[model samples]
Target: MNPSRRGLILGAGAASLAGPTLAQTDGLVLNGRFVQGGFAMGRAAPRAIVFVNGEALTTASAAGLFVVGFDRDAPPYVDIEVHAGNSVGGRVARRTLTVAPGSFPSTRINGLPQSTVEPSDPALLARIQQEIALKTEGFASRADADDFRSGFAWPLDAYRVTSRWGSQRVLNGTPARPHYGIDLAAPAGSPIRAPADGIVTFARPGMHFEGGLTLIDHGQGLITAYLHQSRIEVLPTQRVARGTIIGRVGATGRATGPHLCWRMKWRDRNCDPSLLIGQNAPENS
Candidate 1:
């Protein structure tokens, strides 16, 4: 049986997406925020397929739940097409996604470990490079199921945010990749829960910079990572339910204090974790 049509109204005026006013479609519904570095959950008729910005997307759930996201340097707009499920020939619904612009703050830090801010030694550089390769291979998405449709939650029950996504990292006045994750300050032994249902892909005790880390694949190229963990309770390839304890927060590797760096990546693009499940979400979801 087709599920009842239920979703958030994301029209120009009804939405708080902070983007260009977009026209609404009759049957398409979206929740979450719509902006650069942001992600949203969408709903369509059952068995419906979707395409966003010319890229084919698999629905996040069997009930036609899907996701749309914008990159850090995404354009102002994107095109979306939803092929609705109907008894007869299905209808096509097309809509434009207006991605709002965002600004990143730059910070300059002087005091840091020599190996951290810059790894001048050949051995250390080699180790860092190997770690990067390991991460890239481990995080390669495997979206065989719609595990993420269950929704998201905070890793730490009681925590404070220390840093935000898209912050410029000026290490010793030299530019580096912008910080792409939200840093949550928690005690070293603070338990961390899985924000959503996913399969653990990478769970290891140490990395060059991340220290102990874990990656959970949530289908359709959507993966969430937990960094600076003091302990990883789950093993690779293990399925975990939402709210399951996956690890514990810690100050490891290149970190300054005890914290968990929560990050989300959709395909090859990094997205803001806060937008997907933070204050910016519609209805604070």
Candidate 2:
């Protein structure tokens, strides 16, 4: 059989078969947890085949365990398929996963008074829409996983972490969106840096929702956003090396205090920023 056709057939069968039963066949058993934009798998058969929502992922070695992430957000339930083939025979297995929404952290503002202003003021809403468009247009590219793995850097100087990625949040006794990025608490004038080498795409001050925002486009459809800044030091279309100072943290636009809300996106998929930073990693440019 042609390798591509064989792969498809194996994938289809794997999608319907149980891991253990497939193991009894010529294929290896595969198990994993699936979530929006990310997955974790273990004890896969050596040289096993893997597919997520019908998309094939590159496996680097014959190790039975692997992980995969996507550049798009997936709904709650996702399908996973796997197959393992050797000279003698192969097996296929399929499973379903229910992904939970990521949690965001709560940040307490020390000196701001409670505001009575309506959050839905027409002028504010329009400006927010414009900003979202700019951000969306800036990140609308598709790149494979290899493009992101080249190297990762901290976008800003390491400071005391005010909030962590994926922490649950409650605003004023009401549940709000989960915190998507790691927050670094620094002085209002503390300089903010880029996490990786990329081109500046969007740099604007006080549009509507975001007070001072800067966005960078890393090649292959990856982008980072810096929001609620007190100052923007870079201009749109400027090329920045990793760790370059682009702005300073501040309480701008709907914020209660001075802090930086650094966010990362792979196309439309929001991802955790902490995963890309490691100890003693070079502060690239």
Candidate 3:
């Protein structure tokens, strides 16, 4: 068979095992299907847990089984671990997996400086704790799933990318961590728009690390966050349309200059925002 035809057959075979199926002994790939089914130990009520690269994933149940999609831009060879949590406590109870590369388009990130912190200061630690809490809260239950799947657009126009997502950084010449969001270099007071239709979940001015921040729930556990804004034009619980002007760019909190940091999350799993925009999004809007 031709290479393209062989790949199509393989993809079809993988998709056929949609419901409870056998787990691959090797790795899972982004946008790829695999059979990951079994009973997990430790919970009195039997709660399912999934993790990718040590980060827990929020899974959705369907047809007597659970299914999950890897982040569209996840790195190659991610480890997937499953466990069950209960009222007693949590324990690791399943297999470890390695993820391979699939057919998703690759993204090239640019323009971020390397920086790091010891994370030793009490204040900084506390702030980190707070941010963690916010992320872990999950998406709003009322969010509609159809809205997010419809499509997305660029949230801003005429801006240069100051930082791209997934860039490993060295803070103070020491390796720190990877950047998780795409930052747009815009002057303070420049309009920042919404990428999709959603309801505002958070709108707070001047947080410990994020400066002014707004989080919009785009349904189906998908959320978009805007950080380091100089002004917030939306309110909590407010419904916003795609392309709505929700805020303005600014240097807020720990940032050194005015910029818009755009972030996307599926539950707690972070994904790159650039993958959702059209080719003409930056140039036309």
TM-score of each model, paired residue for residue? 0.82, 0.60, 0.61
lDDT of 3 by residue, 252-285 (tens): 8657688888887766456666555531110000
Candidate that would win on lDDT? 1
lDDT of 1: 0.73
lDDT tens per residue, model 1, 1-285: 111111233454344443322335456666555567876666666667777776666543456666766778988777777777632247766666556677778866566576787789998888888888889977786566666565678889989987778888887677879988888998789999988888898898778688899999877668888998988899988999988999898887778889999998887788886665532212111
Name the weakest run of 10 consecutive residues (lDDT summed) in model 3. Answer: 36-45
For candidate 2, what is the lDDT?
A: 0.56
Q: Give me the runs in candidate 3 sitting further than 4 Å from their true place.
A: 1-69, 72-116, 138-142, 279-285
Candidate 2: regions farther than 4 A off: 1-52, 55-118, 141-147, 279-285
**What are the per-residue Cα lDDT tens digits for candidate 2 across 30-63?**
3222334333333356556566677654331344
What lDDT would each prediction earn against the true structure? 0.73, 0.56, 0.55
